[model samples]
Target: MDTQGIFDSSSTVRDCSTIFALSTLLSSVQIYNLKENVKEDDLQHLQLFTEYGKQLKKDNGKKPFQVLEFVIRDWQYDYDYAYGQSGGEELLAKRLEITEGMATELRELRQHIRSCFERVTCFLMPHPGFEVRKKSFAGEISKLDEEFKTALKELVPSILAPANLTPKLINGGRVTARDLFTYFKTYMTIFNSNTMPPIESIMKATSEAALLAAMQVARELYETRMARVTAGLSLPRPALQQEHVAALQAARAACIDKNKMASTKDVNESLARLTQELEALLPQYLLINDGNLQKALGEAKDAYEASVRRVHGADLLCVHPSDLQTIHNEAVAAALRVFDARRKQYPGIPDDNRTKLLESFLPRLDELNTLNNEHNRLFVADAKLSFMGEVERLLARDPPLGPYEFRNEYNRAKNRAVAAFKRRRNMPSTYYADVYEDDLLRSIENRYYIIREINRNT
Candidate 1:
């Protein structure tokens, strides 16, 4: 790979270095083109592999890639050197030894590449048949010399044949095309950001991608199953509840089952998404149920008040002491029945909708009961007034009867007034009734004494 570019030299240098570094990871076979010899300076490009060696060793163990050293113009016959029958590998090694100031660099290059690529095997291009003077473009393959053609024929099949250059393998498993694309894309992003993309980052990106894909699959699976089950229809609370829970469990199981290799975080993220999707189904149910809840509450209130009215009457004067609690109990029971009858229409996931109806209905029921008591108080007040009027009418009689006769008539009148007061009232509690009767008798006694004083004076 070329490591020289025209931009900011340092920036471009790092970019190119990073590119070369990642390229080693992707390639099964790496090639280096040289003009004549493996000079000391030519090894500079290989120096970039220094830091990645440990990472490569960890990933691939001792396995290595094939490296081809393609030396052009080396086969040209001259007075000092001539073509021989020696093997290309032997000739290249001999030439490296002869080159000045190349031994140390070559050894270091070998060591570094060994660490980075494990046991990399270097191949010299096969000897060419004939010499060509000019550089040729790749598009002119047909016009190239027979010697160049022969070299390519030997090189291409050596790497491309059968399992010679297999796809990148990680932990003994071949990487899929999708994984490879993700890797390259990650590397490019890091390269563009002027950062060296570490192997750890690449692995992390791969893991994140797997988790995201798993979450998506789980989400889709859950939605598909639920959609088919519900068919865009708003189901009752019990049916919806059963279906939601089952679908959520199956989706979570699918995510876990399909990606058993996923980490805890990955699995948790996918499960969280499933939960969210399950809850999403509830809004429609809630919307429909909210209306039902209101309707149920209204019905409960009406039922409670209707029962209260049947016993208390519109004036509410008929209520007795025991009627307060008894009426409330019966009303509450009726309200509960109202809610229970419509329970299927409301969402019950969070809480029983019946509770909501009772919460609202009970308070209003109490208020109605209070109104009944207030009206009953008015009834008691009216009875008291009527009793006082009868006593006053007896006192206002003209030409009062003689003392003994007046006493007899007063007793009879008081008895009749007490009976009349009792007849008009419904509250059986006699606490107020006794007090009013005592007041009437005391008033008549005072009148009787006054009549006796007048008779004695005459």
Candidate 2:
């Protein structure tokens, strides 16, 4: 059932038509009741509404109106006129024909309604009690004549026959129940104002609202996942990177899946906004990874120092140079391991962060090795000086002895110096120690010879 034409002089009729217009915004299938035949006034009113719908479609993306069915009621009363004795395509064509000049207005109206609503169907319905009046009425529908009961049954299914009963769509997204409230409120406000708002205003407001809702959903999911992934702010680079990737995938899927029934264009737009939001989040992760990696490098350096101290005491260069090299190698290896363990792996992110940090640390290890070399040189020098001092003290005498006695004194002093050098804990290699000892003894022997020459002259 519907209202009279919007142009009706009756204020109540116009008001009712306005209400009908509001219903059109939400309608998927509209059933128009006809007394016996299609009237020119009825077509004119429907055409006016169809024009309004077209305006809506122009302003918005698409129309919600899908099916329009005209039911000719009590058609059994005029069976010959209604069926035209053929009751097939011939009847329908003859009824809808506009060959007469009196129906010029109706021709235009029918054309307009057809353009607005693509799926148009008409059904001939008889009075429900007409069968009972014949005293042949049965309780069940199968007992009744196929006219009234069958027509009702067929009308219901036909109205619902569309494979997909699509809902209203704005922009590209499907209008949700929450959106319906806003839509009705907007339309009623304009309607109550006694003026219709422009289509642009309505479309813009509603479309933005729908798009925002979609974007919000995506952002919330993305944020939740990212927050969990970065909560401690200390994830390994690779682990954090993997989590970020997973978060992005899940966010996109959620946005698309949630709005799957929406227009493809609308869904894409929402996804685009989500992409932008994800882009904005990237800088934060970069900073975190950068700081984390630096901290890792520092920890690696500390580990290197600790390992060195644990394996080789403070006197690093006291052993053979090769042994010091071995200690340095072990410490450096341990430090590299520490750095590697701390390094994070980020997918699609550059490996330069880890690579650069590791590279920078290598120079520090080299510097440490140099420091050990210097320490070794000082230890060997100190040992040689102590040995020489001891030999000089042993050989010096107030009265110089003969050559054989001098030789024996020299050998005794030399043996004692060698023993003292060996007793020092932080000594260099034994081969190095022997080389220094021989040089010190040669110098002492010359002094002994001078002493002997002085004794002989006396």
Superposed by TM-score, candidate 2 places the C-alpha of residue 357 at a distance from the truth, in angstroms, of: 4.5
Candidate 1: Cα lDDT at 208: 54
Q: Which stretches of candidate 2 lie over 4 Å from their true place?
A: 1-214, 227-246, 311-317, 345-358, 398-458
In terms of lDDT, the best-performing candidate is: 2
* Model 2 C-alpha lDDT per residue in residues 1-458, reported as the tens digit of each score: 34454344566654856666666655556666667766666665575566655665555445536766667776754445443222423444565566767466667665556656746666777666545666556566655556667667766665565764656654445666766665666566556755554555444444555556556666778888877655533455566667777888888887775553356788787888788888789668767666766777788778777876775566453444455556667776787787767654455666665566557656865776676556544544565566556545544655656678766765676566556544443434534534344554565556666755654554
Give lDDT per model, in order: 0.57, 0.61
Indicate the residue-level lDDT of 444 in model 2: 52
Q: lDDT for model 1, on a 0 to 1 scale? A: 0.57
Give the distance in Å from residue 412's predicted Cα in candidate 1 to where it truly belongs: 99
**Model 1 spans with C-alpha error above 4 angstroms:** 1-11, 41-44, 48-50, 56-109, 125-142, 195-458
